[model samples]
Target: MPTARPRLLYVTDLAYPARGRRYGDEDVFLTSRLRAEFDLALCHPGDAVSLMDAFDAVVVRNSGPVLTYPEAYAAFRERAAERGTPVFNPLTGRGDMAGKGYLTDLTAAGYPVIPTVDRAADLHRLPETGRYVVKPRLGADSAGLRTVTPDALRAVLAEGAATGADLLAQPHVDFVHEISFCFVDDAFQYALYAPRPDRRWELAPYRPTLADLAFARRFIDWNALPYGVQRVDACRTPDGGLLLVELEDLNPYLSLDALDDGTREAFVTAFTASLRRFLAV
Candidate 1:
């Protein structure tokens, strides 16, 4: 039912005011490139539910955290399901899109993920650390994350329990650096890393080894997304092994500017091809 050039409803918040990054600039660049292949219109996350039905598919990017507009997001999801509206990230993601619960599941299953537990009673499962990172299960973009002492960890979890809010706790990892593997439709596109964990947005291009690719690929295969972008974030341990920090399956930032010209062009080409393939289905 699509015309010569299919219509795409590109969802984004151009002025999200995030920390250490310009979400608007990145999205403007992406949309400019994407316009070459499709008739695209960008809309705010709050407007997508009302405007999406007219477009062939909706591409969510730079929309910021769901907590900012929970009601709008829930309505969007509900309407999309009722009408079977095509979403690029496909709503069946089992990773962060669902919640942080997958981290605990992966930990229990013996994956290389940093050990995580949702309930206070499960604290014994996590390694002993002077400080633990306690975060809300449904949080994103470090919205409800905190680093606290052991006593504070229990107090916070208990307080969350009293209020019927879900939380997860993990040991603070002492890693040499944080690396991210970017992918498009289950295929590896490129990789980047930050030497100093304190400066998360200051990234440099990384040449991944076979073992490194294997480590990242395992999580990609586990997620098994039909189509869309994914970023597998991991930390390099002192002993030269990687641990899964998080699996970002929904609207993961591509960080295209950090890449060289050739690599950036290749990524855009692959992303366009992947979108075409996704639309075909």
Candidate 2:
């Protein structure tokens, strides 16, 4: 007798109008591939909490920014935890899955990240630059991100303080280009980069050097998720060193379309194997 495949409730927002990215196309391609190994059902993120209990695990991908549906996301997290339903990325994620506060944690730990602070008094910790970036600690996809002068940032923080809003501030780094390291489980898969600084989604295949892989691995080591996918985004400083931009552990938009057929297939295989391993545990 053949073994039964795991049932996976895949959560995504296919209609989300992501700037310079195709959330629908990527998720479509991925779920199509994933269907070979699992009984997969795709649903809008809003419906995940209701649908997930019937499946063996929930694979959250391209669900859009939680800022758009904070309450729904919160409920989903709560329900999943209460029922002990296996989540693909798992709730233990410490990076973007949790929130941008990880940036402040990394900064304080002296990780190679753009210095981030959330309070008015902590502003002095960041180096003085022409401008600083003020963004919500829970923000994603550049939502609620802005550049401002130091004085303006202080005012923003002051307002946040008054309103009790979660916010973070960081020095604007003059970086040469942005790159991302994609991984399945803890193993590296592929890398992509934006050659043009202005175009964040205009990605091209990047060949990582041993040094580059080492730098990206630092965050992977930090998060230490036993399974699931991750993307380590970083920028090249003028001094030829890398500073982390973000570590996306939850539903990272894998530029599968950008990869060659072989590479894309390899990612699917790795992802499938990871899911099986995750199920075993």
Candidate 3:
């Protein structure tokens, strides 16, 4: 008798209209490759809770911003956790998976991150800038993100406090460009950067230095997930130092299209191996 291959429930929102990236294209490519290894099925975020039980593991990829389906996402998470299901990137992630609260935590811990504060009283801790960014703690895809003068920031905080909403404030850094370091199971995979900040999705291959890897590694270590992929996003300041922008441990867009054929193939190989190991555990 032949052995049955592991089944994987691949969750994605193929129709999600992302600003610069094509969530559907990426997932379509990924699922095509993943199918070679596992018996895979695609479903939207709204259906994950009901379908995940039929699979051996769940691979959450390009599911789009959870803010759109907050109740469904919450229910999916709760069910996955309660059933002890193996979720890629594991639901235990402390980075973007949990919320933006980690920014304040990393800031307080002296990590090289954009200075962040979550309260009116703590605003003093941030440097004086012409503009500050105010964003919801649970925001994604630039949702609820705005740049405002200090006065406007204070007002926003006051309103948030009144509504009991969690928000984070950060100084508007004048960075030259933004870069992201991708990893699979604690291993560095590749790096990409946007030379023009205005066009964030125009990515090019980036060759990371020892320092860059070290910087990205800190957050990966901090997250401490024994398995799963992660993307450490950072900005290059005028001073040539990198500061953490976002540590994406949950369903980060791989930007596979930006990569060369060889590089894209390598990523698929690494991703497949990672998934295999994850299932064996």
lDDT of 3 at 175: 93
Local accuracy of candidate 1 as per-residue lDDT tens digits, 146-208: 999988888888889999788899999999999999999888999999988899989999999
Instruction: Output the lDDT of residue 39, model 2.
Output: 88
Instruction: Write down the lDDT that model 2 would get.
Output: 0.91
C-alpha TM-scores of all predictions: 0.97, 0.96, 0.97
TM-score of 2: 0.96
Runs off by more than 4 Å, candidate 3 = 1-3
lDDT by residue for model 3 (7-105), tens: 899999999999889999999998888888789899999999999888888889899888888999999999998988889979899999999999999
TM-score of candidate 1 versus the correct structure, residues matched by position: 0.97
Clashing residue pairs, backbone N/CA/C < 3 A, model 2: none
Q: Each prediction's Cα lDDT score?
A: 0.91, 0.91, 0.92
Poorest lDDT segment (10 consecutive residues) of candidate 2: 1-10
- lDDT for each residue of candidate 2 in 99-180, tens digit (9 for 90 to 100): 9999999999999999999899998899988899989888987888999997799999999889988899999999899999
